[model samples]
Target: MAIIETRKLTKSYGSIQAVRGVDLSIEKGEIFGLLGPNGAGKTTTIGMLCTIIRPTSGSASIAGYDIVQRPSAVRSKVGIVFQDPTLDTILTGYENLELHARLYGITSALRKKRISEMLQLVDLTDRRNDLTRTYSGGMRRRLEMARGLLHRPAALFLDEPTLGLDPQTRARIWDYIRKMARKEQTTVILTTHYMEEADQVCDRVGIIDHGQIIALNAPGNLKESMGGDLVIIRTKEPPLVKIKALPYVREVKFNDGVLEITMKDAHLHLSGLLFMIPGVECVEIRVPTLSDVFIKLTGHDIRDDSAEDSGSWIDSVARYRQKGK
Candidate 1:
């Protein structure tokens, strides 16, 4: 069953359309990744579903509650970890979870039990009493994850969960995420810049660009869609015409003096390709990655895009909470 569903969901900011006519049905307990370059509507779509930003057209529901009509219920069913940190530095990790539990109206006994389990789950039990101001970035992120899951929400939304973490820390975070999903059967909807991490953790990913989802599928399937082996050749002068004429060649793209060609059986054709294309300084044959898929579909590296257009929505959340106060 779909715990999250949307139809023609859209959010327009005056003359600028942030998210346009997005349709999605995410199954229960599924780990879904929303992949896109900056300003591609990934965050906007997430904001709408999380009820942080209202859609201008269409509708959506989370855990069977209408986002617009029953926003309180929707909020109760989902947990969110924004791209920007929102933790209170003055409070200890334990205090943070305690505050959230109280806000959710969790009974005293249940709240204590839940906080204990979450602290251990995130491996922060030892430092739970320490002020959050002293916590390391990775430790803080794990604490955020634990806090988000404290209420046992039906779904969790994470935006750039491991943006600045080291590789080992990132791996540990993903492990915690998987364990939580399996133990609680909670659906995870996250937006991330790390393609490899998404490919590893997500069961399916949606690639959005220009306020629309251009592709949605499992990582493997999406990468497979890029056709056969990817042969990247660094050449000032590429033999584009001859390469295109090859019957086995799937596609060819040249940018910044590098040729990215997808073809069948690269080992069989690399020698011939090298012979045909002059000034071939380098040759690399590898499988297609999520980054490659993004470049192929969007014509730009996901990292190359500027994030300025993707203004921070966490501030909006702060403002919303201020109103509630």
Candidate 2:
């Protein structure tokens, strides 16, 4: 049975539909990733599935319990780590986990055992007694993960879990998450805007855009779907002229002075491309990546939003219409 299921789930605030119809099914013991650009409804979907907000329509189930009908049961089976640190800065890591355990109604004895296990899981057993305020960003993130798992939840929800951590720290957290899934057989659903993170960690990924899922599949399958290798060309001249003329090129686009080429066989065409286009300074080739797939599908970089406005749904809608939606 699917550990988490959503059928046409949606959320709206007044007239603005924050989340459009979204359907997803996550199996047990799998790490599923929800990926999208900012304001693309990834958080809204997580909010609904986590029962932090009611969906405007449709339904969701967690661990066989309906989110709307059996909220308590569903909550009991799921743990969440939010994008922002939710830890109490003044409290020690152990204290925070203990408090979380109490909130979840974990037995006192089990709580103690779980806290110890969790601290060790995140490699924070030595720092368990230190106040969270004294911890580094990476340390606090690990502590938060430990606290979330204190109740032995069957499913874990991580919203941008490694957002601000350094690369090494992020890698360490990824190891812990993978280990937890293997050892505990826990199903994890993580939301991230980082394509590399999703590609590297998730067993399967759903690419969301404009409040809808644009693509969904295993990372390798999704990359394979793009068909063939990717060749990135850097040159002093504008790429449009050369890119349009290149043979065997499936698609070509230029952004920020970098030329991206998608081809069926990058190796077969590299020599030809170099010979054809002058002023080519550098060439890089690799298998299709999640970032490459995202760009190919969306025609825009995930992190390249220059819009200068922030407000509630009502304001966004009005602005969107005024600017011609």
Question: For candidate 2, lDDT tens digit of each residue in 170-200?
Answer: 8888888898878777888999877887898
Task: Report model 2's TM-score to 2 decimal places.
Answer: 0.78
The true-versus-predicted C-alpha distance at residue 187 of model 2, in Å, is: 0.7
**Per-residue error at 211 for model 1, in Å?**
1.0
Q: Candidate 1: misplaced stretches above 4 Å? A: 231-284, 300-325
Report the number of the highest-lDDT candidate: 1
Model 2: residues with Cα > 4 Å off, grouped in runs: 231-284, 300-325
Local error of candidate 1 at 55, Å?
A: 0.7
User: What RMSD does each model have against the real structure?
Assistant: 8.9, 6.5
Consecutive 10-residue window with the lowest summed lDDT within model 2: 300-309
Worst 10 residues of 1 by lDDT: 310-319
50 Cα displacement, candidate 1 (Å) = 1.4
Q: Candidate 2: which pairs clash?
A: none
How well does candidate 1 score on lDDT at residue 228? 85
Q: Supply the TM-score for candidate 1.
A: 0.78
Tell me model 2's lDDT, rounded to 2 decimals.
0.83
